[model samples]
Target: MLNGLKVGDKAPIFEGLDQNGKKISLKDYKGKKVVLYFYPKDNTPGCTAEACNLRDNNTLLAEKGYQVVGVSIDSVESHKKFETKFELPFPLIADIDKKIVEQYGVWGEKKFMGRTFDGTHRTTFLIDEKGIIAHIIDKPKTKDHYNQIIETWEK
Candidate 1:
């Protein structure tokens, strides 16, 4: 498993610029459940689908006391365009330096279409109000990620 981090572990704190260039930190959401999701890139098919799924269910997530945060190696500019294009309602961290991904251990080797490359793995950490990881979704279904999250937490 990435980072060897497991449920109940304290999540690594992160601070970075979001799509709007606003500073966001994990500490800022203290006392709130956090849906910390890491995607490979912005605008890719799977990534877009995953983001839109979260966006569509953002209200429900908030109603359940969950705050969503996205992170990728994409730049702030790229994130801005992606956010605008998709009308995403959550913060997309412009992790251009890969610090957050590295900290989360989501950055690593990946394979696609008979090719291998180093990139960010799609992963989600369900963080509780206390900043401890309550669960981890190592392979989220992009098209139905909202349901997946809700089910995981409900269990």
Candidate 2:
């Protein structure tokens, strides 16, 4: 397991600049369920797919009292371009200092093509209204991430 956080644990509170340079924090959605997703990069294939999937289902998610937020180690400018390109409706936090990822325990060593490197692990944390982690999607399916979230919440 790449995460130290567990279901029912209090989700860590964090603040960062979103794509629009607006300050966004976990506490902003205090009374609403949160879909806090962390991705490796902004424009990568899997990341794009996951973001778009969430974008497409944003209305449905909102109807269910869920708020979506994305976090990545990319800069604010990078996130702005990605968000504009994909018409993403949610805030994408630019975690350039890596504090949020570290707090969430999603920053660690990852191996790709037999090469080891430090990066953000793609993970989704479903935080309930009370700021407690309700579920953790360690290996989210990018193309169908929204459904995955809904199903997990429903179950």
Candidate 3:
């Protein structure tokens, strides 16, 4: 597995289908700050909280010049359902092949309930306008995820 990426590293580029089957690429958000977040699955509790928090503050995030995008190994259909259920305003990338997660170095071994398995680690990358990583939140606070991004950027 690839080592975790750090701040100042070049943000990995990726393109994948979103909930609506439209292609989303990191390069598309060039010249703008991007909040690239990775979650284990769609519709899960923590994932839902994080996504909802971002959705609830979409206007504020936009006003702060941030574009949010979520990624998970879930299928496009699943992403669509989750987005519809939560009314998420940003695109949730369907990383079915796991390529995007691997590119961003978020795919790895995880431990939960005394069991270990390979999965996507819940992580967030703040990509600056120039495509460089401004900050990385490895252990995100699910309910206050948006604040973490904002505070990091503002700092």
User: Which regions of candidate 2 fall more than 4 Å away from where they truly are?
Assistant: 1-3
The lowest-lDDT stretch of 10 consecutive residues in candidate 1 is 1-10
Better of 1 and 3 by TM-score: 1
Residue 152 in model 3: lDDT: 79
| TM-score (all chains, Cα) for each model | 0.98, 0.98, 0.97
* lDDT value, residue 92 of candidate 1: 96
- For model 3 the local lDDT of residue 101 reads 91
Cα lDDT tens digits, model 3, 79-126, are 999999999999999999999998888888888999999999998988
* Span of ten consecutive residues with least summed lDDT in model 2: 1-10
Report the Cα lDDT for residue 69, model 2. 97
| Candidate 2: count of backbone clashes, pairs at least 3 residues apart or interchain | 0
Residue by residue across 66-152, what tens digits does model 1's lDDT show? Answer: 999999999999999999999999999999888999999999999999999999999999999999999999999999999999999
Those runs of model 1 whose alpha carbons end farther than 4 Å from true positions after fitting are none
Model 3 worst lDDT window (10 residues): 1-10
* Residue-level lDDT for 113 in candidate 2: 100
**Clashing residue pairs found in predicted model 3:** none
How badly does each model clash, as a count of residue pairs?
0, 0, 0
